[model samples]
Target chain A: QQPVQSPQAVILREGEDAVINCSSSKALYSVHWYRQKHGEAPVFLMILLKGGEQKGHDKISASFNEKKQQSSLYLTASQLSYSGTYFCIEGGSNYKLTFGKGTLLTVNP
Target chain B: EPEVTQTPSHQVTQMGQEVILRCVPISNHLYFYWYRQILGQKVEFLVSFYNNEISEKSEIFDDQFSVERPDGSNFTLKIRSTKLEDSAMYFCASNLDREPRAFFGQGTRLTVV
Candidate 1:
Protein backbone atom coordinates (compact mmCIF):
# COMPACT_ATOMS: atom_id res chain seq x y z
CA GLN A 1 0.00 0.00 0.00
CA GLN A 2 1.06 3.57 -0.56
CA PRO A 3 2.32 5.58 2.34
CA VAL A 4 0.24 8.57 3.47
CA GLN A 5 1.81 11.98 3.73
CA SER A 6 0.39 14.79 5.82
CA PRO A 7 0.10 18.53 5.21
CA GLN A 8 -0.25 18.04 1.46
CA ALA A 9 1.16 21.49 0.98
CA VAL A 10 2.98 24.19 2.91
CA ILE A 11 4.35 27.67 2.32
CA LEU A 12 7.26 29.09 4.27
CA ARG A 13 9.32 32.24 4.29
CA GLU A 14 13.10 32.41 4.42
CA GLY A 15 14.69 30.88 7.51
CA GLU A 16 11.39 29.31 8.53
CA ASP A 17 10.92 25.63 9.35
CA ALA A 18 8.50 23.00 8.13
CA VAL A 19 7.79 19.31 8.65
CA ILE A 20 6.31 16.63 6.43
CA ASN A 21 5.03 13.38 7.82
CA CYS A 22 4.54 9.93 6.27
CA SER A 23 2.79 6.94 7.73
CA SER A 24 2.12 3.46 6.48
CA SER A 25 -0.21 0.71 7.60
CA LYS A 26 2.45 -2.02 7.57
CA ALA A 27 5.82 -2.39 9.19
CA LEU A 28 8.62 -0.40 7.58
CA TYR A 29 12.13 -1.65 6.98
CA SER A 30 13.30 1.71 5.73
CA VAL A 31 11.94 5.12 4.80
CA HIS A 32 13.35 7.28 2.07
CA TRP A 33 12.88 10.99 1.44
CA TYR A 34 13.23 12.66 -1.93
CA ARG A 35 12.72 16.15 -3.28
CA GLN A 36 11.81 17.22 -6.78
CA LYS A 37 11.86 20.68 -8.23
CA HIS A 38 9.47 21.83 -10.91
CA GLY A 39 10.30 20.04 -14.18
CA GLU A 40 13.12 18.11 -12.49
CA ALA A 41 13.60 14.53 -11.42
CA PRO A 42 13.40 13.56 -7.76
CA VAL A 43 16.62 13.82 -5.75
CA PHE A 44 17.39 11.46 -2.91
CA LEU A 45 17.67 13.21 0.44
CA MET A 46 18.16 10.66 3.18
CA ILE A 47 17.15 7.21 4.37
CA LEU A 48 16.19 5.99 7.82
CA LEU A 49 16.96 2.28 8.12
CA LYS A 50 15.86 1.58 11.66
CA GLY A 51 13.82 2.95 14.48
CA GLY A 52 15.32 5.91 16.29
CA GLU A 53 17.87 6.54 13.53
CA GLN A 54 18.02 10.10 12.20
CA LYS A 55 19.73 11.27 9.02
CA GLY A 56 20.27 14.79 7.71
CA HIS A 57 21.55 16.87 4.87
CA ASP A 58 22.26 20.52 5.34
CA LYS A 59 19.30 21.62 7.48
CA ILE A 60 17.04 18.81 6.32
CA SER A 61 16.67 15.85 8.68
CA ALA A 62 14.37 12.88 9.09
CA SER A 63 13.36 10.36 11.74
CA PHE A 64 11.92 6.90 11.46
CA ASN A 65 9.51 5.36 13.95
CA GLU A 66 9.38 1.74 12.88
CA LYS A 67 6.97 0.81 15.64
CA LYS A 68 4.52 3.44 14.44
CA GLN A 69 5.19 2.79 10.77
CA GLN A 70 5.91 6.49 10.35
CA SER A 71 8.65 8.86 9.29
CA SER A 72 9.01 12.62 9.29
CA LEU A 73 11.14 15.01 7.27
CA TYR A 74 12.20 18.24 8.90
CA LEU A 75 13.31 21.26 6.95
CA THR A 76 14.96 23.82 9.14
CA ALA A 77 15.81 27.39 8.17
CA SER A 78 14.24 26.85 4.81
CA GLN A 79 15.59 28.56 1.74
CA LEU A 80 14.01 29.57 -1.53
CA SER A 81 15.90 26.77 -3.23
CA TYR A 82 14.11 24.33 -0.97
CA SER A 83 10.86 24.95 -2.83
CA GLY A 84 9.74 21.65 -4.32
CA THR A 85 7.66 18.52 -3.84
CA TYR A 86 8.79 15.90 -1.35
CA PHE A 87 7.93 12.20 -1.52
CA CYS A 88 8.44 9.34 0.90
CA ILE A 89 8.91 5.75 -0.23
CA GLU A 90 8.57 2.85 2.19
CA GLY A 91 10.64 -0.26 1.62
CA GLY A 92 10.62 -3.77 3.10
CA SER A 93 10.95 -7.41 2.04
CA ASN A 94 9.15 -6.84 -1.25
CA TYR A 95 11.69 -4.24 -2.32
CA LYS A 96 8.82 -2.62 -4.14
CA LEU A 97 8.21 0.98 -3.22
CA THR A 98 4.89 2.77 -2.96
CA PHE A 99 5.43 6.50 -2.95
CA GLY A 100 3.35 9.06 -1.13
CA LYS A 101 1.41 11.60 -3.17
CA GLY A 102 3.99 14.11 -2.07
CA THR A 103 3.99 17.37 -0.10
CA LEU A 104 4.35 20.55 -2.08
CA LEU A 105 6.58 23.01 -0.33
CA THR A 106 6.88 26.61 -1.45
CA VAL A 107 9.63 28.64 0.12
CA ASN A 108 9.48 32.32 -0.58
CA PRO A 109 11.98 35.04 0.17
CA GLU B 1 29.43 11.40 -9.43
CA PRO B 2 27.94 8.35 -11.12
CA GLU B 3 24.35 8.89 -12.23
CA VAL B 4 21.59 7.13 -14.10
CA THR B 5 21.01 8.65 -17.52
CA GLN B 6 17.99 8.46 -19.80
CA THR B 7 17.65 9.44 -23.43
CA PRO B 8 15.11 11.47 -25.39
CA SER B 9 14.11 13.52 -22.37
CA HIS B 10 10.66 13.85 -23.96
CA GLN B 11 8.66 11.75 -26.43
CA VAL B 12 5.28 12.17 -28.07
CA THR B 13 3.43 9.29 -29.67
CA GLN B 14 0.02 8.24 -30.93
CA MET B 15 -2.27 5.63 -29.43
CA GLY B 16 -1.53 1.98 -30.38
CA GLN B 17 1.98 2.89 -31.38
CA GLU B 18 5.06 1.48 -29.71
CA VAL B 19 7.30 3.57 -27.47
CA ILE B 20 10.70 2.72 -26.10
CA LEU B 21 12.19 4.62 -23.17
CA ARG B 22 15.89 4.10 -22.70
CA CYS B 23 18.05 4.31 -19.63
CA VAL B 24 21.65 3.80 -18.60
CA PRO B 25 21.85 2.96 -14.94
CA ILE B 26 24.77 3.91 -12.78
CA SER B 27 27.81 1.80 -13.53
CA ASN B 28 28.45 -1.08 -11.13
CA HIS B 29 24.83 -1.22 -9.98
CA LEU B 30 23.21 -4.65 -9.91
CA TYR B 31 19.51 -3.86 -9.84
CA PHE B 32 17.37 -1.85 -12.25
CA TYR B 33 13.82 -0.60 -11.94
CA TRP B 34 11.21 1.36 -13.83
CA TYR B 35 8.63 3.73 -12.39
CA ARG B 36 6.01 6.09 -13.74
CA GLN B 37 4.28 9.19 -12.52
CA ILE B 38 1.29 10.84 -14.04
CA LEU B 39 1.08 14.58 -13.88
CA GLY B 40 0.19 15.71 -10.36
CA GLN B 41 0.17 12.13 -9.11
CA LYS B 42 2.37 9.94 -6.99
CA VAL B 43 5.07 7.86 -8.63
CA GLU B 44 4.23 4.19 -9.13
CA PHE B 45 6.52 1.21 -9.46
CA LEU B 46 6.36 -0.66 -12.75
CA VAL B 47 9.03 -3.36 -12.51
CA SER B 48 12.41 -4.42 -11.23
CA PHE B 49 15.12 -6.41 -13.03
CA TYR B 50 18.16 -8.17 -11.74
CA ASN B 51 20.52 -10.79 -13.17
CA ASN B 52 18.97 -10.20 -16.60
CA GLU B 53 15.53 -11.26 -15.41
CA ILE B 54 12.53 -9.59 -13.86
CA SER B 55 12.39 -9.86 -10.10
CA GLU B 56 9.07 -8.13 -9.59
CA LYS B 57 6.41 -6.22 -11.48
CA SER B 58 3.32 -4.24 -10.56
CA GLU B 59 -0.17 -5.03 -11.79
CA ILE B 60 0.03 -1.98 -14.03
CA PHE B 61 2.83 -3.71 -15.89
CA ASP B 62 0.86 -6.10 -18.02
CA ASP B 63 2.01 -8.20 -20.96
CA GLN B 64 2.27 -5.10 -23.09
CA PHE B 65 5.15 -3.82 -21.01
CA SER B 66 8.60 -5.42 -21.31
CA VAL B 67 12.08 -4.59 -20.05
CA GLU B 68 15.40 -5.52 -21.57
CA ARG B 69 19.06 -5.15 -20.87
CA PRO B 70 19.84 -5.54 -24.57
CA ASP B 71 23.51 -4.88 -24.00
CA GLY B 72 26.03 -3.55 -21.56
CA SER B 73 25.21 -0.07 -20.28
CA ASN B 74 21.66 0.01 -21.67
CA PHE B 75 18.24 -0.85 -20.26
CA THR B 76 14.95 -0.12 -21.95
CA LEU B 77 11.21 -0.26 -21.30
CA LYS B 78 9.02 -0.91 -24.32
CA ILE B 79 5.28 -0.49 -24.45
CA ARG B 80 3.87 -2.64 -27.21
CA SER B 81 0.71 -0.62 -27.72
CA THR B 82 0.74 2.74 -26.12
CA LYS B 83 -2.50 4.20 -24.82
CA LEU B 84 -3.45 7.78 -24.18
CA GLU B 85 -3.45 7.04 -20.49
CA ASP B 86 0.21 6.08 -20.80
CA SER B 87 1.22 9.69 -20.94
CA ALA B 88 3.45 10.29 -17.97
CA MET B 89 7.05 10.67 -16.83
CA TYR B 90 8.94 7.37 -16.71
CA PHE B 91 11.88 7.11 -14.36
CA CYS B 92 14.63 4.48 -14.39
CA ALA B 93 16.44 3.59 -11.22
CA SER B 94 19.28 1.39 -10.00
CA ASN B 95 20.88 0.38 -6.74
CA LEU B 96 24.08 -1.28 -5.67
CA ASP B 97 24.12 -4.81 -4.31
CA ARG B 98 22.03 -5.32 -1.17
CA GLU B 99 21.35 -1.59 -1.01
CA PRO B 100 17.83 -0.27 -1.04
CA ARG B 101 18.86 3.24 -1.90
CA ALA B 102 17.89 3.73 -5.53
CA PHE B 103 19.34 6.41 -7.77
CA PHE B 104 16.82 7.67 -10.28
CA GLY B 105 17.38 8.96 -13.75
CA GLN B 106 16.09 12.33 -14.88
CA GLY B 107 13.20 10.43 -16.56
CA THR B 108 11.62 10.35 -19.98
CA ARG B 109 8.39 12.29 -20.38
CA LEU B 110 6.13 10.19 -22.63
CA THR B 111 3.05 11.81 -24.09
CA VAL B 112 0.76 9.38 -25.86
CA VAL B 113 -2.14 10.98 -27.66
Candidate 2:
Protein backbone atom coordinates (compact mmCIF):
# COMPACT_ATOMS: atom_id res chain seq x y z
CA GLN A 1 0.00 0.00 0.00
CA GLN A 2 1.02 3.60 -0.55
CA PRO A 3 2.23 5.68 2.35
CA VAL A 4 -0.02 8.33 3.89
CA GLN A 5 0.92 11.97 4.14
CA SER A 6 -0.71 14.38 6.54
CA PRO A 7 -1.97 17.95 6.15
CA GLN A 8 -3.13 17.58 2.54
CA ALA A 9 -2.55 21.30 2.19
CA VAL A 10 -0.74 23.99 4.14
CA ILE A 11 -0.37 27.72 3.66
CA LEU A 12 2.45 29.69 5.19
CA ARG A 13 3.81 33.20 4.92
CA GLU A 14 7.28 33.48 3.54
CA GLY A 15 9.96 32.93 6.19
CA GLU A 16 7.56 30.90 8.29
CA ASP A 17 8.02 27.26 9.14
CA ALA A 18 5.96 24.18 8.33
CA VAL A 19 6.06 20.44 8.82
CA ILE A 20 4.69 17.65 6.66
CA ASN A 21 4.49 14.09 7.84
CA CYS A 22 4.30 10.65 6.18
CA SER A 23 3.49 7.33 7.73
CA SER A 24 3.01 3.77 6.62
CA SER A 25 1.42 0.59 7.96
CA LYS A 26 4.44 -1.55 7.18
CA ALA A 27 8.06 -0.77 7.91
CA LEU A 28 9.65 1.08 5.04
CA TYR A 29 13.05 0.11 3.68
CA SER A 30 14.00 3.54 2.48
CA VAL A 31 12.17 6.83 2.10
CA HIS A 32 12.67 9.50 -0.52
CA TRP A 33 11.46 13.06 -0.46
CA TYR A 34 10.55 15.16 -3.47
CA ARG A 35 8.99 18.51 -4.29
CA GLN A 36 6.96 18.92 -7.44
CA LYS A 37 5.58 22.07 -8.95
CA HIS A 38 2.38 21.94 -10.89
CA GLY A 39 2.74 20.55 -14.42
CA GLU A 40 6.26 19.31 -13.64
CA ALA A 41 7.90 16.10 -12.59
CA PRO A 42 8.97 15.42 -9.05
CA VAL A 43 12.35 16.82 -8.05
CA PHE A 44 14.45 14.53 -5.94
CA LEU A 45 15.24 15.97 -2.53
CA MET A 46 16.82 13.36 -0.25
CA ILE A 47 16.62 9.78 0.88
CA LEU A 48 16.69 8.20 4.31
CA LEU A 49 17.84 4.59 4.33
CA LYS A 50 18.41 3.67 7.89
CA GLY A 51 16.36 4.19 10.98
CA GLY A 52 16.74 7.58 12.68
CA GLU A 53 18.41 8.92 9.56
CA GLN A 54 18.06 12.67 9.12
CA LYS A 55 19.10 14.76 6.13
CA GLY A 56 18.99 18.42 5.29
CA HIS A 57 19.17 20.50 2.15
CA ASP A 58 19.26 24.25 2.43
CA LYS A 59 16.43 25.17 4.80
CA ILE A 60 14.59 21.93 4.20
CA SER A 61 15.26 18.85 6.29
CA ALA A 62 13.73 15.44 6.92
CA SER A 63 13.79 12.73 9.55
CA PHE A 64 12.72 9.13 9.68
CA ASN A 65 11.72 7.14 12.74
CA GLU A 66 11.90 3.39 12.43
CA LYS A 67 9.56 2.65 15.28
CA LYS A 68 6.76 4.89 14.09
CA GLN A 69 6.95 3.80 10.45
CA GLN A 70 6.96 7.51 9.78
CA SER A 71 8.95 10.33 8.28
CA SER A 72 8.72 14.09 8.71
CA LEU A 73 9.84 16.93 6.51
CA TYR A 74 10.70 20.26 8.10
CA LEU A 75 10.78 23.45 6.14
CA THR A 76 12.43 26.31 7.96
CA ALA A 77 12.44 29.94 6.94
CA SER A 78 10.33 28.89 4.00
CA GLN A 79 10.78 30.57 0.67
CA LEU A 80 8.34 31.16 -2.16
CA SER A 81 10.23 28.61 -4.21
CA TYR A 82 9.29 26.03 -1.62
CA SER A 83 5.69 26.35 -2.62
CA GLY A 84 4.91 22.97 -4.12
CA THR A 85 3.50 19.55 -3.39
CA TYR A 86 5.81 17.38 -1.27
CA PHE A 87 5.77 13.63 -1.64
CA CYS A 88 7.36 11.01 0.56
CA ILE A 89 8.00 7.80 -1.33
CA GLU A 90 8.71 4.48 0.31
CA GLY A 91 11.46 2.57 -1.45
CA GLY A 92 11.44 -1.17 -1.21
CA SER A 93 14.05 -3.69 -2.18
CA ASN A 94 15.10 -3.69 -5.85
CA TYR A 95 14.20 -0.02 -6.11
CA LYS A 96 10.43 -0.34 -5.91
CA LEU A 97 8.75 2.87 -4.80
CA THR A 98 5.30 3.73 -3.50
CA PHE A 99 4.33 7.37 -3.18
CA GLY A 100 2.00 9.11 -0.84
CA LYS A 101 -0.78 11.36 -2.08
CA GLY A 102 1.34 14.46 -1.39
CA THR A 103 1.30 17.54 0.85
CA LEU A 104 0.69 20.86 -0.87
CA LEU A 105 2.62 23.71 0.67
CA THR A 106 1.87 27.26 -0.38
CA VAL A 107 4.25 29.92 0.72
CA ASN A 108 2.92 33.41 0.21
CA PRO A 109 5.04 36.51 0.23
CA GLU B 1 24.49 18.57 -14.02
CA PRO B 2 23.34 15.86 -16.36
CA GLU B 3 19.62 15.19 -16.14
CA VAL B 4 17.13 12.63 -17.38
CA THR B 5 15.45 13.75 -20.60
CA GLN B 6 12.12 12.69 -22.05
CA THR B 7 10.79 13.47 -25.51
CA PRO B 8 7.43 14.67 -26.75
CA SER B 9 6.65 16.90 -23.79
CA HIS B 10 2.99 16.45 -24.64
CA GLN B 11 1.14 13.82 -26.63
CA VAL B 12 -2.52 13.54 -27.56
CA THR B 13 -3.76 10.23 -28.88
CA GLN B 14 -7.05 8.59 -29.61
CA MET B 15 -8.33 5.72 -27.49
CA GLY B 16 -7.50 2.19 -28.69
CA GLN B 17 -4.35 3.49 -30.37
CA GLU B 18 -0.74 2.73 -29.55
CA VAL B 19 1.63 5.27 -28.01
CA ILE B 20 5.28 5.27 -27.10
CA LEU B 21 6.89 7.55 -24.54
CA ARG B 22 10.62 7.98 -24.79
CA CYS B 23 13.33 8.87 -22.32
CA VAL B 24 17.08 9.33 -22.18
CA PRO B 25 18.35 8.82 -18.70
CA ILE B 26 21.39 10.58 -17.31
CA SER B 27 24.51 9.17 -18.87
CA ASN B 28 26.32 6.61 -16.70
CA HIS B 29 23.20 5.86 -14.68
CA LEU B 30 22.39 2.15 -14.71
CA TYR B 31 18.87 2.05 -13.30
CA PHE B 32 15.72 3.30 -15.03
CA TYR B 33 12.13 3.62 -13.92
CA TRP B 34 8.75 4.73 -15.16
CA TYR B 35 6.10 6.45 -13.08
CA ARG B 36 2.83 8.21 -13.79
CA GLN B 37 0.54 10.65 -12.08
CA ILE B 38 -3.06 11.08 -12.99
CA LEU B 39 -4.21 14.67 -12.98
CA GLY B 40 -4.39 15.82 -9.36
CA GLN B 41 -3.41 12.40 -8.04
CA LYS B 42 -0.40 10.74 -6.44
CA VAL B 43 2.56 9.69 -8.51
CA GLU B 44 2.44 5.94 -8.96
CA PHE B 45 5.26 3.60 -9.84
CA LEU B 46 4.80 1.42 -12.90
CA VAL B 47 8.08 -0.37 -13.47
CA SER B 48 11.82 -0.42 -12.84
CA PHE B 49 14.55 -1.64 -15.15
CA TYR B 50 18.18 -2.54 -14.62
CA ASN B 51 20.80 -4.42 -16.60
CA ASN B 52 18.61 -4.10 -19.68
CA GLU B 53 15.76 -6.00 -18.11
CA ILE B 54 12.76 -5.28 -15.91
CA SER B 55 13.74 -5.68 -12.29
CA GLU B 56 10.43 -4.91 -10.66
CA LYS B 57 6.96 -3.82 -11.64
CA SER B 58 3.84 -2.75 -9.84
CA GLU B 59 0.44 -4.32 -10.35
CA ILE B 60 -0.42 -1.21 -12.29
CA PHE B 61 1.93 -2.48 -14.99
CA ASP B 62 -0.12 -4.96 -16.93
CA ASP B 63 0.17 -6.78 -20.23
CA GLN B 64 -0.70 -3.63 -22.13
CA PHE B 65 2.28 -1.71 -20.69
CA SER B 66 5.79 -2.60 -21.82
CA VAL B 67 9.20 -1.01 -21.34
CA GLU B 68 12.25 -1.42 -23.51
CA ARG B 69 15.71 0.04 -23.58
CA PRO B 70 16.05 -0.15 -27.33
CA ASP B 71 19.54 1.27 -27.29
CA GLY B 72 22.22 2.55 -24.93
CA SER B 73 20.63 5.97 -24.70
CA ASN B 74 16.94 5.53 -25.21
CA PHE B 75 14.44 3.86 -22.92
CA THR B 76 10.83 3.71 -23.97
CA LEU B 77 7.44 2.76 -22.57
CA LYS B 78 4.81 1.47 -24.95
CA ILE B 79 1.11 1.20 -24.33
CA ARG B 80 -0.50 -1.23 -26.71
CA SER B 81 -4.02 0.16 -26.59
CA THR B 82 -4.50 3.48 -24.88
CA LYS B 83 -7.53 4.16 -22.76
CA LEU B 84 -9.07 7.38 -21.52
CA GLU B 85 -7.80 6.54 -18.05
CA ASP B 86 -4.27 6.23 -19.44
CA SER B 87 -4.16 10.00 -19.75
CA ALA B 88 -1.57 11.17 -17.25
CA MET B 89 1.86 12.70 -16.91
CA TYR B 90 4.38 9.90 -17.37
CA PHE B 91 7.78 10.51 -15.79
CA CYS B 92 10.99 8.70 -16.58
CA ALA B 93 13.68 8.48 -13.92
CA SER B 94 17.16 7.10 -13.42
CA ASN B 95 19.59 6.39 -10.63
CA LEU B 96 23.12 5.08 -10.22
CA ASP B 97 22.42 1.90 -8.33
CA ARG B 98 20.50 0.28 -5.50
CA GLU B 99 20.77 3.47 -3.49
CA PRO B 100 18.07 4.95 -5.66
CA ARG B 101 17.79 8.70 -5.41
CA ALA B 102 16.39 8.91 -8.89
CA PHE B 103 16.55 12.03 -11.03
CA PHE B 104 13.36 12.57 -13.00
CA GLY B 105 12.77 13.87 -16.50
CA GLN B 106 10.47 16.72 -17.48
CA GLY B 107 7.68 14.19 -18.12
CA THR B 108 5.33 13.49 -21.00
CA ARG B 109 1.71 14.51 -20.59
CA LEU B 110 -0.22 11.71 -22.31
CA THR B 111 -3.76 12.70 -23.17
CA VAL B 112 -5.75 9.75 -24.48
CA VAL B 113 -8.99 10.97 -25.94
**Candidate 2 per-residue C-alpha lDDT over A7-76 given as tens digits, one digit per residue, 9 for 90 to 100:** 9999999999999999999889889999999999898899998888888979999999967489999999
The clash numbers for all candidates, in the given order, read 0, 0
Candidate 1 achieves a global lDDT of 0.91
lDDT of 1 by residue, A1-109 (tens): 8889999999999999999999988878888899998777899998888888888978999998848498999999999999999999887554566789999999999
Measured by TM-score, how close is model 2 to the native structure? 0.95
Tens digits of lDDT, candidate 1, B11-110 = 9999999999999999899899999999988899999998999999999999999999999789999998999999999999998888888989999999
Residue range with the least summed lDDT across 10 consecutive positions in model 2 chain A? A90-99
Expressed as tens digits, the lDDT of each residue in B24-109 for candidate 2 is 99889898999999999999899999998999998989999999999899999999899999999999998887556788899999
Model 1 pairs whose backbones collide: none
Tell me, by lDDT, which candidate is best.
2
Cα lDDT, model 1, residue B32: 91
For residue A13, what is the lDDT in candidate 2? 100
